[model samples]
Target: MQIKPKFGVDQLLFGMKQTDVKSIYGNPNKQFKDEDQNVIYVYNQQKMRLTFYEDEDFRLGYIIASDPELTLFNNTILGRKATEVQKELEQHSFKTWEKEDFDLAENHFNEDHWLILQSEYDQIVKVEIGAIIKNQDEFDWKFGAK
Candidate 1:
């Protein structure tokens, strides 16, 4: 019950609005508007998926997860053993990368934040967190850039 790995929780960072993400994760069992209209929010009991745009006043911006009880910044959870969470995200300095035919693994704490891991026989089913938007056509209409 300690899932505070980042990408909006303790001060709700990335652009912030939507009533400060509904005062921190409330009322979103589901919501929609995509096709470039943005404004998506799903919570599947905290498995998470948030994306808001309406030209930034809708804020939030994106935070998708596959939740294995979701944890990241060093504690690295989400079903573990993707080489032990890529050696605890390279002992906390991050900078990892591996695609391995889509077994996937990534960690780029720059170019506007990142962390994704998806493995199969080696555990870690899925986990994704991306927040980049420096206006590449509004981040390709809210994350077709991913």
Candidate 2:
């Protein structure tokens, strides 16, 4: 899987409805409404969890993946040390992360870019991302355009 911040991942673009994704990935292993009332689809075999928008549109807004081959900026990201990943993001000029330190998990989020990395055992374990939605209807691609 690929992480294209402020855009889409692979063929799955933000603003795509659940049905749009179903056409590509087929039936999910599990599906449910999240606490925030957004629809969620989990594909266990693919190690992915997709979350849609909360409002009526139900566009694809967020993605969480644990796939070992997941790459960001052409670099394989998962399983690397957190510092290494941070450096890579910095190299891309993505600074200003909202970092949270905890006993088990260290979280970093660049809200402006809507990219998140979570680390356990000092190693990056998961990548979560969302498009910069504008007017609740479109993916703001300006960030990636830079």
Candidate 3:
């Protein structure tokens, strides 16, 4: 059996934070009232939603992704609450983050992790590895997957 090398979705959700959502997608596109009249931040797209809202305390609210791809990501991560994702992110070594989302190519990945930014023209990916670095290495970090 050949096990594909892909990052675990559970890991992605484990250490995520509300700030991570904001940093990734900026602000939500729409705001509206739920049945409770709480301010709902709706970053909605075709059949997709990355919503946020505040509780009575006014602290950072939950950031949720309501898309089918989220379900296919990893069963362990399915239906994960915002707080759950934040916890997972905390466990992994801190790596640089990207705002965009989409497919990543092999060149984008290092030995350990890669952050891919979804863009209109091209996808930007940032790679991070677990190793000691005495100095910077020169590699053409930007290239298409194809």
List all candidate RMSDs to the true structure: 12.7, 3.4, 17.1
TM-score, candidate 2, is 0.87
Q: Candidate 1, residues 1-146: lDDT per residue as tens digits?
A: 23333344333456666666678777788899999898988878677777777776677756766755566663646666676666666665665464555334533232324555666666676666555545655432231223
What does the lDDT come to for candidate 1?
0.59
Best by lDDT: 2
Report the Cα lDDT for residue 66, model 3: 30
The alpha-carbon lDDT assigned to residue 2 of candidate 3 equals 12
Alpha carbon deviation, residue 142, candidate 3 (Å): 34
* lDDT (CA) per prediction: 0.59, 0.82, 0.32
lDDT of 3 by residue, 1-146 (tens): 11011321212221234355457556667756677544554556512232222333222222233333443223232234323332454455524343433444222222334322122223221111211222364222111112
For residues 3-74, could you state the per-residue lDDT of candidate 2 as single tens digits?
888776767877788888899899999999988899999988778999987774687888898999899989
User: Model 3 off-target regions past 4 Å?
Assistant: 1-20, 46-55, 60-64, 76-146
Which of the two, 1 or 3, has more TM-score? Answer: 1
Candidate with more favorable, higher lDDT: 1 or 2:
2
Cand. 1 TM to true fold: 0.33
Q: Indicate the residue-level lDDT of 94 in model 1.
A: 61
